[model samples]
Structures are given as C-alpha cells and as structure tokens.
Target: MSVRPLTEDQRDAMQEITNIAMGQAGSLLATLLGVFVNLSVPRINVLALSDVADAIGSMVGRNIEITAVRQSFHGYLRGEAIVIYGRDGCKELGDLMGYDEVLDRTDEIELLLDVSNILVGACLGGIIDQIKGITEAHGAGELSFSAPSLMAENVPAEVLINPDKLTWTHALLMEVNFTLEGRNFISHLCMLMPGGSIEKMRNILDEFVASF
Candidate 1:
C-alpha cells in the first residue's frame, strides 16, 4: 500500500525548516566552489521505497546518468543523505574550486565526497538546530554522520536505487538541489528517513505547531 507518513502540517513545517537549511547549504557551497549557487525549493514527501529511483529521476530528468555519494546520519534524528551530480561529473566544480588539471577517477570521487560533506553537514546541522529548539523534551540529541562514500557513478537515475535491497518499506523524503550559475554543475541532496525517524520528526513537528 502507498504511504503518507507525515500529515500536511508536518510536511509543510518540515519543508520550511528544510528551506532554511538548504539556503545555508547553498551559501556554503557557493563560498567553497567560488560560484553563484541556485537553490531549489525543498520538496518533502512520504513515498514508497520502490518509487524513490523514479522520484530521483523526476528531479534530475528522465534517464539522465548521474554520479552520487551517500552519508548516513544517526542520533536524535536518523537518515541517509544522497548527493547526486549530473553526468558530466562536475569538471566545472573542479575548475572553480581551483583544480587546474583534469580529475582522474579517484580525484573525481574525492571531489564529490568533499562537496557532499559540506552540503550534508551544513544542511543537516541547520535542521537539527531548529528541531532542538522545538523538541518538547529539550533533550533532542545531536546527529552524527558517517563519512560520505561514493554510491553510484555515471549510472542512469532510474537504476540508482534498488528497492528490494532496502530495509525500509516507506521513507520520508526531503529533497533539495543546488545549481551553479553559468556552470555545468548541479547537485541534488535527498534525505530519506525510515519509520523510526519519521515518528521522531512527526513528534517534534507537532510540538512546534502547538507552541505557535
């Protein structure tokens, strides 16, 4: 069965929280890459694990090949964040970020991981701060993240996520993307939280709404 894990109020509040976080992420990326960053509206939903690949495709475009990295976060909040880059693999970013020579496969992966670390860390940090402010217990603990690792390279988005291999049936997806103005660089950050974390998000959000 299809699932909607978050109510409308929860979804909207989360979107606003993520909007603030994404803007922070974009600012940090722009400073790092030495290019103007374009931020997309945060898209929030609860979707089936089976449909995540298609949802990713819809964001990045149909069948477009991609490079991606993932970092898993745990603590008071839990989720895995996937950072997706387009098929050209961010040569533009390398140039803007002061890499004068062409990046070999290893160098490219390293660059992607560097960018992923900044984006995921700043974005999640912003959201966590807000959640801590609103969490009723006031003891909402901090989140800790694993180092970013390469997930997929130059693969079609449709095949990027395999549903059968995932442990969860449904996830709350919070997605946002950053684009570099006048450069061939775009990155989509998709944060997927399973049922346990979804319940935590719902509780925190309810407290937030009640306080206002």
Candidate 2:
C-alpha cells in the first residue's frame, strides 16, 4: 500500500485518541508513585523509517544517554511501543519506585524493566480499549499486544521497528512525555503503527469523530 500523509482531521482525531490513552496511563503511574503525574499532549506524526532517529533526538536531546523498553503489538494492527528515559531520569525513576541503593548496571536494568512494564502496559491497554470500542462500533475486529521487553542500553530509535522487515515504508507515530511533579524525572512514550494500518485507523477515527 502506498503511504500518504494524514489529513488534518485525521491527525487531530489520532492525537485526541492518544491523549486519552496517555491520560489513563498517567493516572496509573500517579497512583503507583503516590505523586502527581504530568502528561504532555500527545503528538502525532507520519514519517519515513529513516527519519525516526532524528525525530527521537528532537524529543530526548542528541547528546543524552538513553535507555528504552520496547513492546510489539499485533492483531487488527501491528506496531511497536517504546518507553525512553535519559540516564539521570532513569536513576530518578528508580528512586521514586523505592530503589534507594546505589544501583549497579544490573539493578538499573531491573528497575527500568519494572517501570517500563507498568507504564507501557497501562498505555497500550488504554489504546487497545479505544481501538476496540471504535472498531466494534464499526464492526471491525480488535487488536492485542505481546509482552514488553527491555532493549539493550542506549538502543537507537530507528531500531525500535526494523525497517528491513517492515511491510510498510512509512509509520504513524504517536509520542507523549511524562513528568513527575517536583522531580527531575521525565520519560517519552511512543507508539508506531505500520503505514499499512493508517488507512484502516483513519476510517475508524472518521467514524469515531462523526459520533462525537
């Protein structure tokens, strides 16, 4: 399928859907941390595979050391979701999660994976629920996701979805930032759906908007 840029209406609709999903995720994090969680408004974009690295650099900074956890989802739609954090942010997050000891590489990895599971699970669950509701209203099948995995240290953003094996040349990218109040911790959560899924997603969003 040929990839096309999303229309203004489609972009807006997708952003709205993502905002709702991230809000749900943020609420879960807040409850778990016993602190207020601030979530950025979701940003939706369509870009070629080669541009993904630049896109991530713009969000997390080019010089910062980073860690990421990736989880792939399949079913009605297929894609990967990544949660990224800077080195300092990772340490702060561990501290917030009740890990006060000096963390070695192993300890840090364990903490990162735990946090990733909670945040990614909540966010993906919210997104899937929205997709199911929209698709069911239009008589379409539902979607599901696999387990989340911790990627190697400082994994490049472009590798989050392997372009060589991808069925589509472009991806629909959704990103949101999460920050904790009175702390220096911040993380970016991104979801990438194959270019092929955009048309179907747009149709569902169109019907969803018409109902609103």
Candidate 3:
C-alpha cells in the first residue's frame, strides 16, 4: 500500500487542531502550576526518520533542564504523545509537586511523567474525540517508558512504534512547540494510524474547525 502523504492543507488543519488542543493543555497546566500560563504561536513540523535526533537536540539545547511525559492510547485510533517540559518549567512543576527544592534528574522525570499524564492525555482526548467521533475522550495513564536521565543527560531518545500499524503508512512524527511567558514546552504526537484513517482524520478536523 502506498503511503498517503498529508497534503499541505492537511498539515495546516493538523496544526490548527494542535493549536486548539495545546490551548486546552496550557489552560490545564496553569491550573496545575498556579501560574498564569501564556502560549506562543505553536511551531509545527513533520519529520523524516533521520531528522528526529536533530529536532530533539535543538529543543533540548534551549535549556539545560528538561522534563518529559509520555502516554499511549489505543482504540479506533492508536498513537502516543510525549510532552517535554523545560528546566524552569520543571521548577515551577516541582513546586507544584510539593518539593521544597529543585528536582534532581530523577525527580524531574517523575514530575514530567505525572504532568504529561494529565496534559498530554487531555490534548489527545480532545483530538481523538473530534477526529474519530469516538467518545472515549480519555487516557489511561501508563508508563510505557520514561526517565529523567533522558533529559538531564542532554540526549534524545528515539520513539519506538509499530511501523506497519501507522495510519499515515509512513511513520510520521508531528511536533509542536508551546511557549508560555519565557519558557518553552514541546509536545510530540507520534501517531501510528493505519492507512485507512487519514481521510477520517481530515473530515473530523474539518468539522471541528467549522464548529469553532
């Protein structure tokens, strides 16, 4: 089966979907952190396999501290979203987690996973509900893989997915960045959609935008 590459329009639509999704995420994050959260124009990119390391490297270099959370969801749709939080953002989060001091590398990872468990879950829930018409707009938090060392070590981890199950036929990596105040947050949506689902995703995204 030939992979149906996303048209520029589809990419635009996906970015819009992320804007909505991340807006909701930022709001929830604000409530969690007890700070006013401001979001910047989200940056979106789709990457080839070779570029993955470069992409992650650029983001991690922006700050010495990094925290990441990852969650996996499956049903009519299957994929994962790994949310990366910056060093200062982790500090803000550590404060929320009731740690009276800075989080060590391990502490940062745990905090990131916990926070991502909430924010990434909510973002994916909204997107899945909108696109798939599957009302299972929820996430079951599980630790597929996570490590504070992954961030503190300044090394990027490659995402592992069942390549043949990916919806786009090709293994597509959708990434978007969120900047609130002066801190940057990155959300990586790694979707493994079967080839049959792209059209449905387009339709759902269209309907979602029309309703807005």
Candidate 4:
C-alpha cells in the first residue's frame, strides 16, 4: 500500500517519542553491562522497503560486516525490530561484561540474541505503552514479541536488510544507535512498521502533541 508521508509535526512528534524509547533501551543496556550508553537523536522516516538499506548504512556504515538480530512484534501497532551490531560490537559487549576469552560461535550467537531481544522488547514496548497512554486509539491491544533470532552474520551492511525478501512495500522507520563512550562498539536499533500501521501512528502522534 502506498501512503502519504507524515507531516512535519507528526514526524517531530515521532522523533521525540522514538528518542524516549531509544533512551529506555539504552538505559537497560547500561544497567545490564555497567557501562554508559550514548544515544543519537532518533530519526523517523517513511521509506520504501528498498530504501531501507541506505537508511541503515548511513547510520552503521555500508562497508563493514554486521551481526544482527531480528524479532517480530504484534499488537495495536505491529512491526519487526532489527538490531545491527558493528563488526566488533559483540566482542566489545563481551569485554564489558567481563568475559575472560572470546566466545565460541554458539555462545556468541546466544549472547547476541539474548541482549538484542531484551532491547527490542524494551524499545518497542516503551513506544507502544507511551502512545497508548497519549491516545486511546490503540489502548485495547496487548503488546507481545516473538523470539529474536540471528538475521545476519558477518554480512555486508548492504545486504543485511533485504527488501526483496520483505512482504511490505513501505514502512515508518524509527532508528537510533547506541555506543559506549571511548569504545568501538556500535549497535543500531531499527523499527519498521508497515503502511497500514502508519495511519494509526499518525493519529496517535496527533493525540500525543495535543496532550502537551
């Protein structure tokens, strides 16, 4: 389905809500690892699925390979959340939590999935909870998540988000990256909602702004 883009007011409202959600995810990670989390201002875009790679690459770099985790969420607003970890992102995570040695292949994937799953649940649930409070439009629905699994492994950034494989045509993309101060670790949390859900979000955002 083709949908018109969100107006500037709607986009700004989305950016602000996404920022809060991002911070919630970051705070969870910081608490888990005992390290500070640096977050970027969240960006909200209504983009074609084919344009998603470019959007992701600009944030995490196209040349480097990434480790990613993917999970699906269902509720008032539905979408998939993909967490992209930089080349050394997982390694840095291991070090931060006091791992004495490099993790084995299975151990690495397990760790990656676990952390990303928690983050996806926190970030997406945060937005849904806040939006529902602001707008009763979707308040009746319950939020839930599927298991997070590996999406890409040492894969080039360009092919990580394969639009051709996705069934949706367009998405409302909200993205933010988390970094450790003075560390090479970087991970981007990207949430994409289909065109159908965008309509609900538009209304929710309007309600959110009016509530202020």
TM-score of each: 0.95, 0.89, 0.64, 0.94
Give residue 156's error in model 1 in angstroms. 0.9
Residue 121 displacement (Å), model 2: 2.0
Q: Which is superior by lDDT, 1 or 3?
A: 1
In order, candidate lDDTs are 0.86, 0.78, 0.53, 0.85
lDDT (Cα, tens digit) per residue for candidate 3, span 84-172: 65546666667655788767867776666677666666566556534543223333222232221232223233322223433343334
The best candidate in terms of lDDT: 1
lDDT of 4 at 133: 73
Clashing pairs in model 1, backbone N/Cα/C closer than 3 A: none
lDDT of 2 by residue, 1-212 (tens): 34577888888888887888889889988887878999898888888876766787787767666788888887767888888987787778667778778788778877777777888788877776776777776665656667667764775544444556665678888899899999988889988887667777888778777877
Backbone clashes, each candidate:
0, 0, 3, 0
**Which candidate number maximizes TM-score?**
1
Q: In terms of lDDT, which candidate is stronger, 1 or 4?
A: 1
What is the overall TM-score of model 3 with all chains considered together? 0.64
RMSD each, Å: 1.4, 2.3, 5.9, 1.6
Worst lDDT run of 10 residues, candidate 3, spans 140-149
Q: Name the runs in model 2 displaced over 4 angstroms.
A: 1-3, 137-139, 155-167
